[model samples]
Target: MTDPGLQPERTHLAWRRTALTFTVVAILAARHAADHPAALVLIAVAWLAFCGTAYTRGRTTTRPLPHLTPVVTVCSVLALAVAAVLVR
Candidate 1:
């Protein structure tokens, strides 16, 4: 049997990291949008989609799904969104 404590610990740490990165992206996006108003809508839309997906994924009970799955997805989305917005 798997260690129960480890599972939750892994989940919590993974989520925490995800939340942190999300916050960072939000901040950066806000800053970029402030300087370039054109990016505002894109950033907002992308963020909303990302958060919605993350929430939906969290509600599922898929076995062996690493706690970092959603977190990584969110982080990657944020990174790409931010890069795209900044570049544009």
Candidate 2:
């Protein structure tokens, strides 16, 4: 079997990629938010935190720390909700 750290490393990299995607979408939302800025703010907050969390998860060796995926998934859903609200 692979070293235990290997799975976390892969999960961390996935989170990083998720963070990148969120950042790009956040920027796009900001550019278009002149009429609806709230969504952009939410997106910015979620994405920035996501970036930080992913970075931390990648570096830390401690077990029992919160998993990055669920946190990210929650934030992503929130972001999506914000977008949906903005669209309506």
Candidate 3:
């Protein structure tokens, strides 16, 4: 008989990796925005940290796995960071 025990863990790891990727892009955006006021850059960094934390926490939830909220959040934050950098 086949088993289906490791799938959830794999899913969690995938999403966690996605979150980390967004966080990295956000960090780069923050660095690129260094010439502007510190507040924007700090906000970007903080948002990235929050995204990573949320994904890490989501990995522990039972059933249904994690929702798309974390992914959406990461995308939104990444977009905002880029926007902030470009607006300068």
Candidate 4:
């Protein structure tokens, strides 16, 4: 029998780290936008969505994950939120 590779495990861990980073950034953004309720909600929602997608992908995927759609969506939303806060 051959040894199973650790790539999948590493990939999952990488996604987990990305989710964590997103969460931290969201919190910081919330602090900076404390006067803006809508921006804070949007940041929190985007972070939660990313976490859900990451969890689903980790559970269902077998091969090296290569999807970027979720990441892009989260980033775009966050960028919008940042821009809104900046303009405030």
Candidate 5:
């Protein structure tokens, strides 16, 4: 069986990886919206919000994960997807 002590470390790493992924995607989306200033601003704001939640969760490893985190993440991704499709 896996060592229980390492589980929190692994979870923390996973959240960091997720935050990195969000950052990369947000950058790409912002680039895609370069021609539209409003869209760029919106994307930046969303990115900031997502990174905030991710890092917050990372720092509070002792607490149970917030129910809203996944919902927010999925919604952000969906918004990005829709924006991409509409842009194209």
Candidate 6:
């Protein structure tokens, strides 16, 4: 059986992974945005903000912020999707 004590650690690790993924994606997007420098700047800024939030939330020992993480995640995803379409 899984140990309950490990759940929070797993969750934190998952968030860290997510932040890492976002960072990688941001780098790729920047490389692709050479023709659209303004958009690249905006995307990089947004991704950095989201990454910071996710990383911090993951490290917190207290309860998850009420509804904040999900909202930030969703907004970041939608922003990235829109940026992808526009950049293309």
The best candidate in terms of lDDT: 6
Q: lDDT per prediction?
A: 0.60, 0.69, 0.63, 0.69, 0.77, 0.78
Taking the tens digit of each residue's C-alpha lDDT, what string does model 2 give over 29-58? 676765666776676677677777767766
Lowest lDDT 10-mer window, candidate 1? 56-65
Best by TM-score: 6
Off by over 4 Å in 4: 1-3, 63-68, 71-83
Task: Give per-residue CA lDDT, model 3, range 12-41, as digits (tens).
Answer: 777777677767766676676766656455
Count backbone clashes in candidate 2. 0
Q: Considering only N, C-alpha and C atoms within 3 Å, which residue pairs clash in candidate 3?
A: none
Candidate 3 lDDT score at position 35: 67
Error of 6 at 61 (Å): 4.6
| Per-residue C-alpha lDDT of model 6 across residues 1-88, encoded as one tens digit per residue | 3346877788789988988889898888878876886667678777977988887887773666868878887877777776777688
Better of 1 and 5 by TM-score: 5
Number of clashes recorded per candidate = 0, 0, 0, 0, 0, 0
Model 2 regions lying over 4 Å from their true place: 1-12, 61-64, 67-69
In the order shown, what is each candidate's alpha-carbon RMSD?
A: 4.7, 3.7, 4.7, 3.6, 3.6, 3.7
In candidate 6, the residue pairs with backbone N, CA or C atoms under 3 Å apart (3 or more residues apart, or in different chains) clash, namely none
TM-score of 4: 0.70
How well does candidate 1 match the true structure, expressed as C-alpha RMSD? 4.7
Expressed as tens digits, the lDDT of each residue in 1-88 for candidate 5 is 3345877787778888988998998888888888876667667767877888888777667786669788778777766776676566
Off by over 4 Å in 1: 1-9, 63-88
Q: If both were scored by lDDT, which would come out higher, candidate 3 or candidate 6?
A: 6
Q: List the residue pairs that clash in candidate 1.
A: none
Higher lDDT: candidate 1 or 5?
5
TM-score of each: 0.52, 0.62, 0.55, 0.70, 0.78, 0.78
Model 2, residue 4: C-alpha shift (Å): 9.9
